[model samples]
Target: MNLYQNDDTTIQIDALNMLKLKKNILLKGPTGSGKTKLAETLRHELDRPMHSINCSVDLDAESLLGFKTIEIKGGESVITFVEGPVIQAMKQGHLLYIDEINMAKPETLPILNGVLDFRRTITNPFTGEVITADDNFAVIAAINVGYVGTLPMNEALKNRFVVIDMDYISGETLKNVIRTQTLLEDETLIEQLGKFNKDLITMAEQGQISEEASSIRALLDLCDLTTIMPVERAVKRAIVDKLEDDREQQAIINAMELTF
Candidate 1:
């Protein structure tokens, strides 16, 4: 859990405090701020089984609760119950992580209200079974603000969980994270990419770019590509190409020119 940042006592303490409360948590942050990574780390630290769902527009009650699938055995057709992540997590006392929860359809989230509040059970309308939540079961969701296709979470859903505001890890910790991920010791390249990422973030914040800010993941991609290609080309393919806007792409090219 401390693998990414050896000395990030702030997040370490915050994570522990959140777990101590044993309440549902919602992590709000900018894209690529390591929100999902934090949730995974919490599950690891707590030693709980983890079930993750990447929330999307298509995810709905049937997809989450359970669905019936037909199975054929010995030429006879039989119906089998297939469990979804949420229910499986509740029954098995695991951590159910909903990544990018705001991307999910509005109708899909009301199911979480009961699971988060004093009412600790979920009913399967399809199966007519009341599934009581286990004490060891918990939920943690991650959301990024201002992302296109994101929905404004309803008030009832917002009231259910204690929210944690997150941002990118500190500069020193980011270097450590890059080192941990790439096992490379090129400090100059590392620093340049970090600064470039910061600049992109600033530009995005200032409404100068419609693309997502460069992330640590993008740096990792650059690291991988540089072993096989030139730094300039790798910067384009692994980082700049992620932006579809021509203007943003040119901006990234200019940034790479200044960095590399």
Candidate 2:
């Protein structure tokens, strides 16, 4: 998917090009700022099969690496390998995407660092055998900044991969995305919504809410779902509610009434 447009912001160009030159990238951004989407786009550019591992507190060393298997159908299948997403990526030299890598357990961080750096190898815990990753194998991690309940990744680990900070797209850029993605008839209404979205984004930046005004993807959802429900209510639920608080919500309600 080409998540970014040719006329879109230039910041993405640097990261997109960097992915081609280097094997490791640490993408840092807010929740809905399109980091993951960009990673997907980069995968297409790299021409490698993509495998994403959603990292969480429960993900540890063994969960990232393969585990041993045993069976008794014919005879004991001791040390038979069952690959994790990382292991599979390594074996095939695909684009390995580690989502929310900072949220991974502390014990998992070191193993990841090893793979990103010169080690390029992991020792199977069960078999005590070391396997080197293919030279073409690459790593890309997307992480959320200022998220709660996430462990602070070790500095040494962070130093290995190049960090790229992604910010929100511009209002005009996002409006284009909304219009292109949605076959909406009322360009005026979309413009109104975009203005409201810009205001909401400013408020969110000031720490007034939990999320941005509304992401481009959210607007696309509004268009996709509007046919299934009332346009007003769909907009309210899909975009307005997430953009504002109770007081702001009531004001938005009054404002929306004027749109009709």
Candidate 3:
């Protein structure tokens, strides 16, 4: 399986060590910085089935734990409690990946407190059954700070895992990622796209553009578009049009012009 590639191996090494110790991990990074990819890499390395939860404001008990539904079995209607990602992970000793965990509602997250802590267990609110995690069960949660619609993770929740800060891959490593991940074949265009990516990231760091506009994922999308469309059109469609603000779109267009 393809793993996360970066100029520095420190993040990957740290994450692997922590996971091997069965410690919970929290991947903190900007959007599209490969937090989920890193989590998947760890899961693959450990050879474990992963159950994922995409946390959002609408996340609730039924989402985290499980829910009851009526089922017709043996010609009779019966109520059964189906397991959710959390419970399934615990019971099956799988890696639990929670993406954008901070996006979940504040009140909804506390249910996992025991599961995340040394207790390694939680009482199913729906079934009144206490569930303890398997020996190999682990949690890997990711959070993107300073994003709209994201809440500050509770201090207690934040303290549960080993936090790894991820940043955008750059330089030759980024160019390599684009070459391998996209359909674009022009070496010159790849180099130009790489430069454009760096400029956008620099602008984001300088607060001239939102990080969303500078995401590597969006950059890859732009690269694929270049295979069939003009670079300018690809830039407009894949990157510029994604931002609602006219100023941001103009900033990206200017940067594209400078790079191409």
The Cα error of candidate 2 at residue 132, in Å, is 2.6
lDDT against the true structure, per candidate, is 0.78, 0.70, 0.86
lDDT of 2 by residue, 97-195 (tens): 889988987766787666778788887665677777887788889888778767888788888888877776556666666666677657776776666
Clashes of each: 0, 0, 0
Query: Compared with the true structure, what per-residue lDDT tens digits does model 3 show for residues 1-260?
Result: 23354445567777888987878999888986878767876877889999999999889889988899999999999999999999999999999999999899878898899999889999998899999999999999999988889998888888888888888877776776777778988999988888898899988988888988888778889999999999999998988887888888899999988887
What would the per-residue lDDT of candidate 1 be over residues 1-260, giving only the tens digit for each residue?
25434243466557657756767888888776777667767876888888888888999887778798999999999988899898999999888898888999887899878887877798887788899988888888888887889999878898888877877654777777677767456788778777877777777667766535455567677876776787899888887777878988888788778877
Q: How far off is residue 170 in model 2, in Å?
A: 2.3
Instruction: Quote the lDDT for 20 in model 3.
Output: 77
Off by over 4 Å in 3: 1-9
Report how far residue 241 has shifted in candidate 2, in Å: 7.4
State, as a TM-score between 0 and 1, how close model 3 is to the true structure: 0.89
Q: Which stretches in model 1 have alpha-carbon errors above 4 Å?
A: 1-9, 211-213
